[model samples]
Target chain A: MSLPLIKRERIFAAVLIIPCILFITVFAFYPIGYSFYLSLHRIILSLPEIGQPFVGLENYRALLHDKVAMHSLINTFLFVFISTFFELLFGLVIALVINRQFKGRGFVRAAVLIPWAIPTVVSSQMWRFIFNDKYGLFNFILFGTDVSSYKAWLAEPVFAFLAIIITDVWKTSCFAALLILAGLQTIPDELYEAARIDGASAWQQFRKITLPLLKPALLVALLFRTMDAFRVFDLVFVMTQGGPADSTNVLQFYGYKKIFTEGLMGYGSTISVLVFLISFAVAMLYIRFIGTKLFKETA
Target chain B: MNRLAFYIVTTLVIFFSLLPFLWFVDTSLKTEIEVTAIPPVLLPSGTLHFYRSSIENYNLLHYVKNSIIVAGSVTVITISISIFTGYAVARLRLKYKGLIMGALLMVSMFPQISIAGPVWRILQSLGWLNSYQGLILPYVTLTLPLGVWIMASFFKELPSELEDSAKIDGCSHTQTLFKIMVPLAAPGVFTAAILVFIYAWNEFFFALLIMTQQEFQTLPVGIALFQGQYTLPWGEIAAASTVATIPLVLLVLLFQRRIVRGLSAGAIKG
Candidate 1:
């Protein structure tokens, strides 16, 4: 009770931090460990009589040869790569447009954020309705009075996949733009003035100055978008439900189907574990590229 | 680009961003006949018929109430816990501060599915499934990283001399935090609360898996699973969607600056 003030303060700090650590350890870290352990066992929810039995690496081996799992993995990658590409492209354009001082810039920025602020479920449903065959905005604009030419866009494999990507890009491009805008704000006007004095055109100045300076923000946006795209479940669950012949199925949805719908608990854990490892690996790579100095700055 | 071209492109970007949601809003106001026209109607008659039906028949209020309870509880609890943690890391002389912050960054990056299975089992063992506490506990844990990071940044910005003078004046660590630092960090607390509330309200994956009962489901889950005997109820779904999104839209319009600052803080600082 009579300890030095420094020791007392340190003890108090430890007490303050313990609760936060406890919540994460119990809920987040524990669950990840449990998921890994479950992946090594064989448990079927419906058939409890079989009991849980550890079969080391068997589920992992099975996942290696599982055709549907393989297909969904491919779909997940395709979704991540394509959607983030468009997200970055569109995000850059929006950031550049709204970056400048203009009339009603706040209004325009708020308008741009509306799609992002709306829940993924609501936006997914909106897109679903928009691509409706008989009476949808997409068809109404395309076919107009030519009712015979209207098609059920979501029923086709290619279009359904495309629709989900389009929905994601629309919703998240604003988020990417916001990050890029933060980066744009950091660039000095003096650099542009110097470039102009040296006779650099607008495009030349952009290429030489803006693009190079924007790399870190662009990478951060890409990292966030990539991770989110891999975890896409609400869109698939709401729109297509893994769909016209499982074409729209992604990794998380497939895992949900395996565990929740099909009751293959152990197998589903394997899929989820794979997801965690992939995300962890990608995050590591991005962190390295962005450098640990970023964390140091925040810390 | 020319002035005219700049204006055109700016207008086009905003229009493209808002069109889908506006179209849904338009559909929500349409008469039943206008909703399903072969060539869809360009304009609505401005009816509230679907909203009435959605409230009465769809039990939209129940889902809204559930969402409010869960999201509100998460925001309050997360912000409270994070205040202490943030002060400890940002103000007090704590060893391993860098490690704790790095660990939190990793937790924030974790995929939900990675933890979904085991967390479900843990809840079931405690027999808390399909309850508000069941959902709120996980949400608090998930949102804590965001809350802590934002709060820490805000706390770090405050002058250390203020806290030191309070300590020299015989104030306890707790008093100095609650009386001095907490008020200064209120904006960060507010930002974190809004973000956490939006996350809990919009979350569908956990809500769908955990809250299977109709009475316990949130708005996103309820709307996602909206059904009818013969066909999908597009009008009612649109009505429910419009209602669910209005608060968030209003939030964006009002606190757009805070929202942007909160979102970009973690990314750009790094």
Candidate 2:
């Protein structure tokens, strides 16, 4: 390519790229910066006549003392940790199954992806009904027409939380499986063949070879699933509404209620900032372990 | 693994994955009385009553129309912008390609709450709240990262010689992109479009905040905000959910391979 043509190409490329950058900056980057600025002031939408006032770190301080906020933070952390653990475990198992050559493999893969394909709000409603006291499949399965023996699952604090977690695990495990399955595809068949030739049992082969090779993909899945699990609003919003004594109140849902519902814009922005920072920290930690191989490949 | 064990595990995985949603589908088909039967009846009477009621009473078609408009617009816009972005990063000699790619990955990681309040305000100021464009703009922004990554990966795999030859034959970059590279990259474009559509169709948070008006809500938001008179409308909710999900179910069945490829393509590259 000639020098002037190369210049033309670069200009054309810039033209192609600028729109995306502008869109993202305006909608995503600017909003984040604006959110931070909003967090530093006291702006109550309901009490507009009071006027906006600089609160410095007043909202952050208030967040520390807010019992409901603290409780929600704890609940969010628990949901992230527990739901991620089960999703990965189930994901690994599903990945292993689908990776095998079997009859109806395509059907099985499609079937496994159905939950993931459905909207979260829809799934939440489905689970909510399942946990219903009177007309629930859960009660029918456990108590089996023993009408008086049925229990209200969502009415209790602990079970409501558990219900949300179960709903999440059901919906997302297949996504984790797909990522892990990609990792599985990259592993050489020779390694497994050699292990079997050396008289290694299936369990031994998985522990020694499969687990080691699957680490990078597992880390990728972990990073994404954890970030998503932290933002657990739709499930809590639909399934329980952070209810049964606020047992399912997650940080995202709590922040949502604070800002949109109660019009506590300043304090809600603070909560949003906290969620962002925590998710960022987790992503950074995972990226360190996964290494800059990701950056290198994309570049 | 033993054959019996393999079959058992497979059955259980499929059962667990499909049961909850299938239960909802079953519920959608039941008679209003059968829906609430204690020790809930496994076999539905297979009536379309709830579907009729949801559409008639809840204005389900209004929500569906809004979802199609929003998700369709987002996909078209995102895919168009991403094609340019992806091509630039993949084939062009950009000075800061790595930096741009990294920024996109960062954007993908951002929590929706972090941007929700300001985005709402931005739309409000522009007089776009409760409007289609308000929701579509953010949806496009959010889905762009995935679109760019998928398209870029696709573009990278194509032979540079093709573009080089086209250039040698006196073709400009724009002509080559449209006539040659795009048709060749049709699969990637299609994959990105599918994923983006699914995302926009399913997004709840921003839609909930931005489209608070009953007329503007998408299917997900509308189904979520469903209200009942005396008791919670389980039957109608189930019906609306089934109606909302059938297209996605059909999508999954038709394009399972492409959807799987797009998802993993976005992840493994990172």
Candidate 3:
């Protein structure tokens, strides 16, 4: 190949990758940069004629004192951490069950994915009905003995929080199972056979062999689920709309309400920027700290 | 695990996972009276009235049509762009593979909330709001990372010698990709298509924000905001939900293995 051919090859490579980079830059990175710009100005859409004036850090300052904003951030963190834990637990259980040789295992695996595959908005609606005061299934299952015993699952603060958590675990735990199952399949059968030959109990074998090897999958699952759970907008938007005194007001939903309903564009953008920062920080932490080490060990 | 124990756990897992959907399906089949019954009608009533009304009266097909258009465009565009980019990153000795991959991953994790405000404004200013291009542009971008990861994994696994032979034959990079690589990467394309289709079909955030007009609403937004004030319209909602889920269920059943492979491909490798 001539020098011209080499130059053409490099150009071809650059051309190949440009569309992907360009689309993301415009639609992804540009919006982010624009949001940051809007965040620094008081640009309320409802009062647009007032003009967007530069108000450095005022939105962030207000966030510090706004109890609702504080509450939403705390709620978001709790939702992410708690749901991730349950998702990991349930995912492991299903992974273990599916890993073993069983009749109709494939069917079960596909069935479990149905929940995860269903649109979150639709699934959240289903759960809303399931948690409804009058005709809810969970109400019947729990307090069916007496009609008076039915507690409005989505009405009260504590039960509403539990409802959101339960809905999340139901929806996402299968994703955890899928990732963990992939990990489980990669484990050499000989390790389990050797452990069995060594008279290791089931629990012992799991602890000594499966757990360590499953760490990479578990970490990946955690990374995906935690980020996803933190941005729980559709679920809350459908099921509760961050209502009943804003008990379930997650950061994303709160930002959404401000931007859309109240038309506080700049303040809402500020909230969104914070969400971006928090999730970005988490991604960096995963890549720099856990992602590197895990990939190295797995490699 | 023992046989009995396995059976028990599997049953529980299935029950826990599927009960919500089953309940939704049941409600979709019921009368309006049965839907709001105090104790709830546990058994599915054998009727298609709600389905009929949902489609005919509520114009559910219009939304479904909108969904197909937006999601189809998004999938085609995302797949086309990702194929070349994935090839470059995985095969063409891109000098900044780590940086490119990392940036794509970060884009994947980019918070939709963070961009919601500016995205809306941009679309509005472009006069693209309530238009198909508006939704497709962002959906394609937001979903690019996933498609790239899916394609790149498949590209990485293909033997390098094949590319060398193509190069030896004086085939240009695009020619090689079109004539040689695409045929081999059909399975990856199929997998990426399925995953991206599911996402674009179900995405509510941008769908709600961008496609404000009723004619352009997707299935998720249409069903979510289906009923107006004073009435819940649970049956119509359920019917719409069930109809929306059918294609996904069929896809899962037919391509169960591919779905799993596509989902956990790169993540599991780590």
lDDT of 2 at A36: 91
Candidate 2: C-alpha lDDT? 0.92
Query: How far is A93's C-alpha from truth in model 3 (Å)?
Result: 1.3
**Chain A TM-score, structure 3:** 0.94
lDDT of 2 by residue, A27-66 (tens): 9899889999999999998999978899899999999999
C-alpha RMSD by candidate, in order: 1.2, 1.4, 1.9
lDDT tens per residue, model 2, B50-117 = 99999999999999999999999999999999999999999998878888888898888888999999
Q: Is candidate 2 or candidate 3 better by DockQ?
A: 2
- TM-score of every model versus the real structure: 0.98, 0.98, 0.96
Chain A TM-score, cand. 2: 0.97
Clashing pairs in 3: none
Candidate 1, A92-113: lDDT as tens digits: 9878877888778789878888
Query: What's the true lDDT of residue B172 in model 2?
Result: 87
Taken over the whole model, the C-alpha lDDT of each candidate is 0.90, 0.92, 0.88
* Model 2 ranges off by over 4 Å: A1-3
Stretches off by above 4 angstroms in model 3 are A1-5, A293-299
Q: Which of 1 and 3 is the better model by TM-score? A: 1
- What DockQ does candidate 1 score? 0.76
Best by DockQ: 2
Docking class of 1: medium
Tens-place lDDT per residue, model 3, B27-136, is 99998788888888788777998999898878999998999999999999999998998888777745666777777788888879989999899899999999999999
